[model samples]
Target chain A: MADVAPNKLRLLKGAVQDNVDLVRGIRTPGLGRRKLLESPPPDPVQRKRIRRLWLWSPLSLVVIAYLLLPSPVVSLRQTAPIKTFEAEIKQTPATAEVKVPETEPQAPASEPHALDRGVIPLAIKKIVIDAGHGGKQPGAISESGVSEKEITLDIALRLRRLLGKTPFEVIMTRQGDQTISLDKRVAFANTNKADLFVSIHVNWTEPREIRPLETYFVGPSDDPVTIKLASMENQESGYSLSEYRRVLEKIYIDTRRDESRSLAKNIQAELYHSLKTINPELDDRGVKMAPFLVLVGTEMPAILVEVSTLSNEEEVQLLTNPDYREKIALALVRGIRSYASNHNGVDRKGS
Target chain B: MEETNETFCVGIDLGTSRSSISASNGERHVIDSYVGWPVDMVARKVIKKTVLVGREALDNRLMLDLRRPLERGLIKEGAKKDEDAVQEILRHLISLIGLKQKSKNRAKLRAVVGVPAEAFRNSKQRLRSALEGVADSVMLVSEPFAVAYGLEALLHALIIDIGAGTADFCVMQGRYPTEEDQRTLPNAGDSIDEQLLKLMREHHPEAQTSIHMIREWKEKWSFVGEPKKPVVVTVPVKGKATDFDITKEMGEACESILPPVCETMLDLLARVEPEYQENVRNNIILAGGTSLITGLSDAVQKALADLGGGRATVVKDPVFAGSDGGLALARDASSSDWEKLSL
Candidate 1:
């Protein structure tokens, strides 16, 4: 009887080992066939044992499934429907009366049309327009006697006029030619609760031929081409090319960069569309991202626009023309309008 | 002796070059020792602020009268008006460690501030006054003792604190430091920087050099003992290209500060009990920012070996060692009656 008990125990151990091996084979990739072929089939006694195991398996499965599955009672309590019902029952008479008005509109909404469904607006709201290089900062006088500051102010005023007609309110950081520090400009946008900000400026190059209408946003993006364009727009007047390049490369991994790229793309698309309609020969200077002090610490979507290259003689001539100035303003207005329309329900007016 | 924890204490390494504060709440932070005030109404118009502290003030020094209050290991009376700025900086630092908030009632602050080893009583009084409003009580201790406390070497130990402003030494005899056990010398990291500046001026007369540029060079390449490579640095001077030969120049500048350091160490060692002198020598621990320079430990060890009596060792983490010691003291003594615990 003792010998028979030891044999039975050996058989049980063998069965458990085989089950472990089966599980291991399932877990390992490309080893199932080899494991199955190497193992012998069950003997007569083992076969009988296996038959007995099959008989008990359903009962064991019931126990295991109960242990493994989440409790139905706990799940019922956690369900939103149950929670909402409980919340309704717990509400005071005053609170319940307040909630009654919310459900009154539902009486006529049994079968709601798809068009009646409200759209979720974009998160953006107020926009602060900073016209760079105003007052004492004339900022790059062109050969044609056009000041960059004057051109920026003209475009900014036009942008405000266009944005005013839209649902989004417009706030000009500087409404007239005024000297505002970079820090103050960013602070003004932040303090006034401006949702999106734009700073307008005209660019210049040492060589006369380099002319491009560029728009800038802060930080870099996944798109390398856009990053390079942004770098070109951010270059300081006297800084060597290598120094500027190094600065761009250093800030490439900055994570808050996607916001900048999105703003740049929106502004570039609108500017290019409007400018191309007026002057096909005007350089399609693409959107770029760079570190600009005026754009820093602005808790909203911010951009800086380089309207035209003041260094180029032909571009300078166009900048001085009153009609061209109005066209530039119109293009900025179109950009602001597009941005505002996409992001509805936000107050864009200056605080 | 084991006792109940009742005294919540903090240790502050209030250095002339870089100041750090550590509390029992497991925080140790460092800030540059600088104070800034607006030059005039015109300057405020440009900067938009009346005062700036630490690195920001140093960076925009063109617009502010930057005063480094602690000069050569003591508070210069001329710069004493900066006490308000210093207090503000300390207040900011304390708030960073989660103690200054009204909500935290875990402990009352009893601080032991480590000043220069040989600081005058007047300077110590000034330090105490600076800490008066910020802490419940403040105690002034020698900087080297604070370093030794952090190391847990209470008996027969020597500490060399090579700070930017001064090299300080203290001999521990299982008690708080006395005047006899402490010594200080003024030629430290900042002194080395001054010497290097003078050298650069003599070598390259046309260079538009500032102390900032010299300090940058020192941080990058300042070394003593032996040269691994030629230290040739290309510095922009007046928007023109210039390469300065700094191999020998840097070596001389760094070495000039060593004589005073060694002398202070020897002076402190002589003051220790003769029977425990050997033990103190073996337990010599080098600490502070200047000790972070490459090969500084080796140089100190070699210098001491030349004296032929004992060995010297450097602390592995000088940056946080003093603060951690103060924290440990705070935790251990926190249960003692607040009135009984000395600040």
Candidate 2:
């Protein structure tokens, strides 16, 4: 009994410590060892301060030393040419191995380098709109034989026209009904330096009355439904298995995930609220995370919006209406404009 | 040790199928973990209440938006109403044990709650937020660990907690269990009920049955081995009641969980030090509501034949084992430690 008392006391002490750790929000040991839970880099404002200090400290020291000296002196030497990111990209081959940028060390954000993606935020200027299904790959055909490709293209064009009147520059993955590989779409966005990427898609589900308006950002998902949708969207992606695995590995550390999620939430809320006032049957599926290939490969905030469900008979009829399509386009523009206003100080009216 | 009048301590087992609370004031109560809200104006008028809980909630489910509120021993995510339901269930349990939160003269409540072995940090944090309003101080521990502590099996014992939603296995090694020492499997009483319902439907296509009825039948006759008498149940078949002998179906459903349970048990046993493996196996304890199933201990003991041989014993009070253990911990913890656990 004496021995039992000590053992019980020790166990109780351990339990108490566990509870203390929980209250302090310290993660349980051995859990979340993955890079996804790795501490994110400092916020943009702090990083900017550090970068300014680093860039000016040595110059300030040199100037002070010169002023203190009785005699003026000058030193000059040949300096090596600094390598620009554009040079590196130009030198690398198209089939070169992909590597995750070393963003962990808080590398000095002194230059406007593309690889230093998350450290600084430039104003939102260029936007890319990707219509999900195109050409021979018709996504989610309705019972009445209306292809998802036709619907997405129509909505994408409408959105492009709506945004054209604003101050932002707009780029589309395809201007017409044309087959474009997922790899080319990602490459085009990166090459053109788009600030935000939006991929338009229509969903399909059983019990046709359930029209779910959902938006997704790239992250690991355990839900079987989300996994199935991701797998279906990833099909026919030109990337090899090894490349896909590499993309998945970086999904957690993608500094853009939070920004993408914020963008998704804005779009989802706007879509649901605007459509609900007009059509009360739509279900707000809420913003979720799924590893869609397009969302995973982008360098900027990216989202995949399932505008509406084609599986619903009523939604199918609504999609066929140009006025209803115009409403969806206007709602999407409002969401994008809101996200931009929050992120890059873009004007709400896109002035 | 410390002043007792100002503090009230209780241990709660917030389970998927049922919840139990054991208080220091010599009160113990158990209730089905069900919460519901009146679904319509007519339902509100008929039920004469804004919310219902436990047996009342289950009884008036047809007129209410009934919610189980828990999935696999954790609060189901993505539903705002489910969180409300969980809060109401906790409130109901506390009220049943004579701890009214609204009473100004009531003592400051300190609680120890038990959850599944592998519950994530996010789930634990969510539970803590949910419990903030119900108790002055709260502590969360794995359910199997609580059961082991309650049974005084702190040294060399393996506890298998077979609850409705999850089967938790923990190996006690004289110190607090770690992630490596615990495993949770989503195969237990609820899975047995589902399997039994599927089998009965396949065997008697015309018979009408519901999951609730199947659950009641399982609680009465669940066993993993051969039955002494034929198991039978009466159900409506084309508007007439008929007796369906479900002995084989019940046996199949009850035995279906054995493979996964045995596999996990052996796996955890393999993880223990070879020197203490025999002692741990010799002192195996089966706990939770599903542990009361007839012949389950014998079946588990038979599975231990591969590791030489072992004994498996069921707790005398399976339903209250977790909550009782929690209560014991609450009482034994020093006042300073309790202060550390305060919300």
Candidate 3:
């Protein structure tokens, strides 16, 4: 019984060795079935001991058979159909009895180059200036009788002239005093691929006394005060076009909102600095957000400037001066230039 | 300047009679729109806090000097006596609205508040600054526009918001309304209450009536034109039961509130284009608590008909309609770029 126990142990060892050989042979690179057979068994004495246990101990034989048989079958079951065909070779009598040696392969020593060569350049090519109101819509009438349409147009034209020397191509949503719809203004920017959009107007107040310089951005996701101003400016141009409406919806979903915000901040900063420098008493009114129909559907970064309160007597008087208009235009141009210089690598993709 | 995706937006409806706040992340709450202060040392000793706000302040009328922030639906900014009361009320109201929530930090707060349509420019700014202290962003829209946005009627619709102090009218033209589209009239539920108080004093000299009692009577039996049954009430005059006739007085008082409402609606109707005129007429929606008056719709419709020819309608749910509309606008506006709205 003691001899039988040692023989059983030898037989189990042999079976385990055979399983390892078969797994290694199948996994070994470039080795075929014939090559596996060319290798000799580890020892003759061990083989005899395993053979003796198989002949004498029936219980050991049954146990060894029970463990060894299922492993190959389980491995075969687990492997994919293509691998199963390769695994079948290990179950063959001659292949199942041998041990196979594993080999290590060395990798070659050359460094690979990057797929992308260098950084890409993003340049502002075109800008769209949208004068908020035109034609039939006179917009807010100042105490001094300055119309919102006239102020916006004056500012827009000045901005266009300031950008004339720059690389940026300038486009005006409305060149003359003609009524242009909000949708049309947005469409012009989208079609032309305008990098930046600026709509200009003047602020108004009830009791015709309050005066301030405010800027607006569109809302839904934009700030409320800005949206109100934009809405107020857009109200002056009442014409609504369905074609631009679709484009506007698309622009709203685009990822340019963040960039638009950055542009707004820069413009607000520039405007605030310039306006404060000119008149310390002038209310900074700061920057606000709103859902302005004109700004809403534009693909580019957009801002609407309420230069000064047309309702205020002093402000309206100043607004009529070419110097004041020039100062506002110069301040806006400076703001746009600063924004463009800082965000040179960002893709504005304006027409 | 801090833009975070997790920023929360808040919509607050600071009504003349009551204030409610709703959050973009789904929270809606209301607080009484009143502030109170202890009148004397005895009252101050009874209540440890120097001030009280909302329902508690309103209920404790005798010991506290109650003050409403708004008069005739506009903030009484420079009023001398109610300074402390207003500030305390605002602080309490802001705290209750959870202005200190974690969302206040990570969330970009865009607060849309409803003010009277005809609010002065300076008054709007003062109100904006007041709200801005508690919010990251503040947007002041007329009360009627908020109601219009609440109802999703941005185009070809008229909003008639009848609150305690004023009736605000606005015409929606497929966009956020401009100043031209809005009008406010300083005649509403409070006006009716005042009329009732005056009429009762004239008719029943011995009958006792306070503004509160008159307001309660107006809330209970206020109607224009006629009611199915006449209203009779017993008054406590010098702690004695006194029967009074309030039917004619209530009807007359309620009727007096209509002229301004009709006149504003007519003005709003005339401002819109002739083509959209019929649509605006058909889509006239009445909102606010005062609009809950029994025969208001029919009477207002009759009034409109008398002006020219058109239809007028009241919203099915007046109480939550304006706030709900503001909430809807906030939800729709959650993904909007805040910078695009600044002007």
Candidate 4:
């Protein structure tokens, strides 16, 4: 009946602004401190640029590599940061258009944001395998009590074992049943200097029978289903407004698009071909593109493959089998091997 | 010559199992958060309606495509029908309070809705989208904060709102509770029902039970610690109605929430400033339907003994506490402020 207190008014204002910010898809101001804690150190942007520069120019790579090397006594402090090679692009328009036929790989593109093609293609040495959901975030559950978190973790661990036999260095975003925020996972992958990221997830579809083996690369998607899937997967992303906006901006222009797409295609193909032997009902949903938070944040080529659908009771039954999980892991290895062999000419036996 | 729209304010607690609304015109109502449509021509003909909501939807669930849209106090993600069901639930609640959205609408509607503490920004945005055509303007706040506001416990009060979907805890430091000042646990009424059903099956293998029946049993007989009397319910046993004494099962199911709830309560209490910690501990308020469980407040108070003794007050009317608090907030906000919050 009377005026609210001054402190009440201030609280009301804060509440109103927080609500408005959520409606506008802007991160709440109060969460800024927590976001800072989750975020990586400030040097990543500079370090990423430097890594890209080294990839683009061999001469700069030699000089910067020497400077970056640990000295015996005197630790060299980086005072003046070197500018990214994008500055050189402005002066050399002819060189931008010419695709290197000998060393460069993947599709040819003149776009400045495209993956650097001047450097010799290298075999993916470090692969960061992220298990989709864990801990409190039980992504999807079936009536039989099987959860997506457990299934993904099992498959991820299996994949790690299979990859252990190969030359590829495997890094798991989560090695156990623990809740890791998407931002933290991204920071882990980036910090570890992973050359590729493969996130494993299980799908849950309606009507229970539509089991699809799908893989996704980082790119904008117009499909409603894909958009919904991305939205669901992006829960508890823990990225602030500025970081989210930056990721959104890169969705279309990401330099890893071509490599990720190629990887997705290979994986999807292998998964469908290998999995259909065990279950003929499995459909190849094809390599589609959506801006999954994991795929968006990783600097290297990344793909999220829905290895199989847990929604289907029969598929879930198969997924529970150790041999079936082994087959899924093998299919993934084959996909990676095929992609590696094609992209960088790294043979499965040689690597 | 212009027609001016009359303004009306509303407060809504869009909960997981139940939703309550309080309007400026002294109309208050609560409904089960359910929405459904007739599954077939026969169902439509028999029900005499295209859509059913709340109790009606629950009663005629076999004949309807029933949906309890809110999962853990937020819209079920990636489900289009569930999203529509949430909208329908809101629309039904608004209509129950006698505000028509389309009848040459003369009244400007401003609503304050309560969501779970620590709800994601995306979930809040989804809730906002669900309220699009229902209200002219809307403000969303945490359910416990709304409860605290309505109680006028402005400073140094802890509100633990245990709803069907989530047990939301908020420590009121005078200002609107931030992410740090609040916590949400999934251990609430629904979890109790689940545990009860599981235990019932384990205890009486012959007794057939469903979630709906378990929910009803929990609402009637749920309690923590010692029960005043044995809880006996008549359930179907091998096609015969038989009475089963589930006192032990009921106690186990209800008390399952004690450890997490007590731990989180103490955790949040410890986070409060040292000088104000005593006041906060003494002013602990419990709201929401689950708080109505017998001896819950006493059990929580017992847990507080470890923290040098404290007080726990159960809200007299847990059902409308959030809605009333939201209504209080809606009434307090000036017209100018509401204008900026247009949906």
Candidate 5:
């Protein structure tokens, strides 16, 4: 102070005094309503500082609390539905919706989805690919530690990727390893106005080593083994047959069954042909009918494909290999592509 | 009787092979008592699951460390891992009936559990310990007493509770049954299964079968008297399933359990007071899972006919008898009878 000029010394003193005043105001006793009873009101600066520091205290505490929570809780908060909503996301405008009609109870029969025997002349605007046995239910296990769920998921995902180039709007029943009920899967297909439903499953049997690529449409079958397989699949539905038999019967009256069978045949054929290059002995178990709960109540043509048998040691080895898995995936894609290409030109009404 | 009110109370018959849960909330479920945890990280990834319960666990036993925690009608002691497995099982069971099926009213649960008659103190403690944070209040009851309480057969009824681990017997005389009125036979479902497996391995040496396969055969075709359609089942040989006749082995194995059960039935009948002995003999109740054998009751009755005139009646709902009885006990349990645990 002694070395400084007069104006500079005054400015320094004023700065010290202002900071002391700010500090005094920050720690000032009775800065609250109690102070109003005894002293003058806080000046504008003190009020502004108090507003900046203390007014948003509750919100600050909340933000801190949110940051401190567990990771799963944070993820759950982010992902859980705020409310039920229907959202449609399309990279390209879905132009084929005009060609396909949504099935109602009294709606006139449009061409059914010919997945197997022949193609129906119709545009498939939407498709649903169902990957079976997710979450708590891991469908089947193989000696090499491969699971049916993984095989189904991998194939479904690969098919989706392959079909991404097409104009079809592909919907997945599940995109991850999680459980979705059979009823829910059916509801999703029906509600989405899906033109076709393709359910993927890896087969299993008691004795093992039975490898085959089989496909199914919904109905009664003469084969006891087919009947047993239907029972096995329906057991997971957690519903009595009597509960859904009437509904299934009513749906059977419609033309969806024919389309489903056609679709199954096409897919089965493609699967056999596509995999012949890699494994010449791949068995084509042929398309058959069975009362699969997943196939029930879908307004569109639905088929459940037993892509391969997990019980078969040879199939298990093939399934574990990424290169072989891609071949299997390509086979499924070729089957669908064949049906799609054929269906585009065929006339509806069983032509 | 204390009313169960809207409070959700459950009765659990946690058997060695199967477990049944009957809740006051109108839910009755029976599941296999098989629990499996993935063996390794690869198994865990392949299974895409951590712990599998019931039939799901049984199906994926290859990639899992399958443990049927209850060996002889009681939780296996001495292993912390087994104890943990039992805890996981109880936890899964409680969640199955409580959270998933019934969404509303997730209040603290009260449970009444049935163990085989004359369970060791350590076994009871082990079971009780397993229920640590699962139930709010729990009481351990004998399998037969639970059935008696559920059936309202508190007096002059000889209850034979045959299960996977042990055949438990208890005679009721208008009060809580004691050790004197109860007898536990170790030769029950598992013993018969073991005998059947041994027989299959010895006789049909070419047939590829496991204890699991044998258990399936026993469950489907086991009989104590006349053969049921030859019990011809397909067993894999060199990865090919071939039809094998296991009728004689199954019949013999089923009968192996009969001598012990009949002997115990007679012994318990003799212990009843002279005036009530005849009534107890006439009102024999055959309960438990193994009691579902096609001709078990008839065999017991035939063996008893040699001693005196008696009847062996099979309970209609064998799976739920213990659980239903346990639920009834939970409803009628005095507040002091339960060991209350904080939820």
Candidate 6:
């Protein structure tokens, strides 16, 4: 071994005759047996390691898949853009066992970080603002003859101005008094990869005295009251009530329902707190579950806010005031910030 | 009006703590009145059902919206999102009685559901709505009255039926015990359980104790006058199971209701016809699941001794007393006794 040349390396360090024999590490002898037959074969331990790896590789692949892939590929692909709740969650330090992939779209760096202590910037980019009941569809009319569409649009624009100060990308379903189809509104949000979906609407019931500030997340309407609200919002939509359960079933796998509910609760709380002074009688109905077509069709954390019933005189007067509308807008901005504050970039690949 | 095989009569003690239903078909069931609905689709799939009743409901409550629809022995009034749960419990009990739909004439169900003493008319109306589709004809009767009816102590016995919810006291005066003859207090087994739960939680903040655990502890180690022995049990604190001594707290919670019951018992005795007051005081019947608490009868009798001589007696079957009485009433009730549905 010491006599070997500097540039030379060999499996067997004895005198070699032909170049082919040296390269192959085998030499022919006149004993009628192979020349290197007497030499040591490959070490049993090293050979066994290679053999074991080959034997266990397939099983390891199955185990890895079982541990990581919690959902189907088709569902992920369909909801890839807007459904980032689980994907974002996977990025947390608690989930060290699963590794998130890098190729997924990242949150914008300019956006305000979540308030969650030491959380990474949640990639909240585009947000869709849907002012309910536009054009021919006059949402709800107040006792004083104020249209719900006007109130919603006014508040939505004000919200746009408030959010404009931040790095977020806000998209309005309709910039003016125009009718955009339900499919088109949700499609616009999905197309833009909106992180959050907020649809603004006013509530209505018989006798016009019901005054409540409630937020709704997409679910099977739990009661007749919820069904009535869903029906009122889902009037023009082509979908039927029969399909509501299916929509809820699909949402359960998407992980958006939980986020949507949290968003609703946050927004509902802020709205009640801000407006409680303007209308002392304003009732905080809290978060509710309903199958509104606008929410069910969306693939994002969506909530429909029944800001205040137009039937109540106090609330109707409150909605009519520009200062009150601005307060409502500011409250909504605060809620969105709170909900998105803890959202951070998480690697959701194989989740 | 005569006894007929076409109709099935069921007597039910629809209590907040426990519910019991006894049918004419000789089937009987008593279950913890806990109902829960799965929280989401994943839970529904994993649980393999939408609604769960009784102990199963409590065991899988994490993934459910657990609804205890009754409070103070009446269907919880003003409690939102409880209608479905109330109906589910009613339907489950009726099913346990085997209301075979395929049978001829559909076996018209005429149920007499025993309720808390002096239950609100609104509560009975709510209960009536809940029982609409389940039973063709139904009647709501005071719980203690039902117990008195079954025991045939309808003459002059004072019934103090202590249950998980309200403590019902009724004066059986030969005729039906009217609302004026009964008193319902919102203090009983459940209230004690709650008090104990609060004490346990406060005493050992790190202990993982729920209402169920507190209830179990109360049932096994409850004593009024004295502990007699150390009332200690192992409870999971933080993560490790550790021995916990709750003798003082358990004793206090169990004894909290005694004063009210004693006062009510004295008041009812005073109100009784002066002639029958002696008999009523002597024959005071302490009947109900909560009456099983050791020394409770003696505690009552001791308290009652202040207002002349009195003796408190325990029932042979506290659990079935109310239902058995309700069954007796249902079988004896005339056609006019049942509430006729408009349909």
DockQ of each model vs. true complex: 0.01, 0.20, 0.01, 0.15, 0.01, 0.00
Question: Between 3 and 6, whose lDDT is larger?
Answer: 6
What lDDT does candidate 4 reach at residue A202?
93
Model 5, residue A24: distance off in Å is 64
Candidate 2 lDDT over A103-145, as tens digits, reads 2112112343223323454578999999886755678887755
lDDT of 3 at A292: 64
Each prediction's total of clashing residue pairs, residues at least 3 apart in sequence or on different chains, is 11, 0, 46, 0, 7, 2
TM-score of chain A of 6: 0.62
Q: After superposition, how far is residue A254 of candidate 3 from its true place, in Å?
A: 63
Q: Which candidate number would show the highest TM-score if scored against the true structure?
A: 4
Q: Candidate 4's residue-wise lDDT over B127-163, tens digit each?
A: 8888998898899999999999899888999999999
TM of each candidate vs. truth: 0.46, 0.58, 0.48, 0.59, 0.48, 0.50
Q: Judging by lDDT against the true structure, name the best candidate.
A: 4
* Candidate no. 5 TM-score: 0.48
Q: What's model 2's TM-score?
A: 0.58
Per-residue lDDT tens digits of candidate 5, residues B232-278? 99988999989987889889888998876777688667757898888
Model 5 interface CAPRI class? incorrect
Global local distance difference test of model 5: 0.70
State the lDDT of candidate 2 residue by residue for B7-32, as single tens digits: 88888999999999999987999999
- Which CAPRI level is candidate 1? incorrect
Name the lDDT value of residue A272 in candidate 4.
Answer: 87
Cα RMSD, each candidate: 32.2, 19.1, 32.3, 14.4, 30.6, 33.4
- In candidate 6, list every pair of residues with a backbone clash: A107-A123, A114-A341
User: On residues B214-284, what C-alpha lDDT tens digit does candidate 1 reach at each position?
Assistant: 87788788888897778887877779778877888889899897776775576566656777777887778
Query: How well is each residue in A123-165 modelled by candidate 5, as lDDT tens digits?
Result: 7879899888865667887764466776787778667756765
lDDT of 4 by residue, A1-351 (tens): 146777777777777777666565444343211222333343877567535433443442233233322342113332111112222322443323221122323322344456543354466899999999876787887665567887887788768767876899988887545566777788889998999999999988776879888998876554557766877787747665435545554554567877898898888889889989879988777777676889988899999998888788888777755458778988999999898878665333334
lDDT per residue as tens, model 6, A26-103: 322211111221123338984574355445434433332332334453244344432343354345432231111233
